[model samples]
Target: MFKIGELAELAGVSKRTIDYYTQLGLLEPVRSETNYRYYPEESIERLRLIDALKKQHLTLEEIKERLQIIQNQPDAADEIVDKIEHLQEEMKHIQEELLELKPLLKQLNEQQIKLMTKPLAQQGYTLLHTLAILLGGDPFIN
Candidate 1:
């Protein structure tokens, strides 16, 4: 959970923007008994999606409607949110593993690096495509 300021900083937006988004029903923050609003980490991904849409020339009203449609889908929004959390965890683990392997990877020759990545290239492209889709980009892009 993140406070408004924390979420604003993390999401690369202003607190005013968050407030405006909350008002527009784009961001849903939980209010505690003390009246403090706490945003989930998933909000960051949502903010990313909103930014992506805005960049594509979507107005707040259109984005809100689109989000409503997405939320109305039975289990689809929930499943995607759950998947995003799981994917974030997986990405953290992969980042840690990559850091641990950095030294060994650095020692590999060009040919050896190519040999190792050959099998992973397809999987890497698939992951990229999936992420692109999640961020509302064209999946067909290389």
Candidate 2:
């Protein structure tokens, strides 16, 4: 269990955000004997999901509805876990590819770099796309 402040820090959100979510019924925290609210470790992942949905332009109500539907699905948790694992594996592969390209990247001049990346950029797969994919975000959103 974590205090509200701790959870906020861990989830990269503000304490007020968590409080607001709690008020909105988006987050549920347990009350201690001291009347302090404490969140479970899973809250971090929940906040991250909420943040991701917001980035996808989902309204709070829409996000809540989606989350409720996901919760009601028996296999949703397992599917999400599988997807996260797959993404981690892909990130590892990307890291290895970047390592392999390090020497070549260093040797490339500005024009050569632009030439190498231009095709990918034209295909909407620029550095931002790579970052979005790595961060489990929808690359095509922007």
Candidate 3:
């Protein structure tokens, strides 16, 4: 068993972060008589996995939910694949929404072409307008 400090060093996170993970039941490090935390080698792997999942921006609750679902399932591999396929479909839907915005994009392109034939000073303003249209407001914004 490794002390909290040792485990933190091994995991490349602060002791406080490890403590927080323990509080969230993400890790189950044992406590000594003096109430010092101690973690096993397997806990290090768990910490690494939790860190990786957090990097994907998933909430701790979401991670816990996923873990529970994984634990309750018999075919974990197939369940994970199904979740991935669902995520892919969501991504495809977003892409379709972007593609459906093509008419506005075409109009913007025409404006850009018009600006290109104009004087240099006018081109800057038109470029700014194009950028504003592409990035400034939400497409569905009022």
Candidate 4:
């Protein structure tokens, strides 16, 4: 049982921000007989999540919708599993990209070693253009 000020301090937010969350129906903290707001331990984690979402630029309505989705879903872990699968696929692609980049990185490293051994007067004409010209430049490139 923590008071509003305590929760605010613990969560690294202001009392006004917590009050705004309550006003926006985002959090439902209990009230004492003196009509002061008190947050439970669960509210602390919820506040942390809310703060994280705000950092991601999520609107209050979007956060509320996500909360609703979690409440209405029977298997919330399903979402996690789907995300894990997606991340695995992305990881496979990233590994392929790294494999492809290895040769280029080795060549660039060789170039750097050559440049370091060269005389300072001969290091002026090294052109490190990218492979983007293979695609004839980006469509957005004018």
Leading candidate by lDDT: 1
Model 3 C-alpha lDDT per residue in residues 1-142, reported as the tens digit of each score = 9998999999899999988988888778888999888898867766655665565467997676655665476356354545555755775796797687656657667778566446644865665566456433444447
What is the clash count of model 3?
Answer: 0
Error of 2 at 92 (Å): 18
Scored by Cα lDDT, where does model 2 land? 0.77
Write down the RMSD of candidate 3 (Cα, Å). Answer: 12.3
Return the TM-score for each candidate structure: 0.53, 0.55, 0.48, 0.51
Q: Model 4 scores what on Cα lDDT?
A: 0.66
Estimate candidate 2's RMSD in Å: 6.8
Q: Taking the tens digit of each residue's C-alpha lDDT, what string does model 1 give over 1-142?
A: 9999999999889999999999989999999999999998878978876775575466898888767877677356656556656766788898898788778978999899889877778888888887678566676965
Task: State the lDDT of candidate 4 residue by residue for 36-138, as single tens digits.
Answer: 8888876776675665556545699877666556557636634533554565576579679768756765766777856654653353222112223321344
The per-prediction tally of clashing pairs is 0, 0, 0, 0
Instruction: Give stretches of model 2 more than 4 Å off.
Output: 81-142
Q: Which candidate is the best by TM-score?
A: 2
User: Model 4 compared with the native: what TM-score?
Assistant: 0.51
Cα lDDT, model 3, residue 102? 55
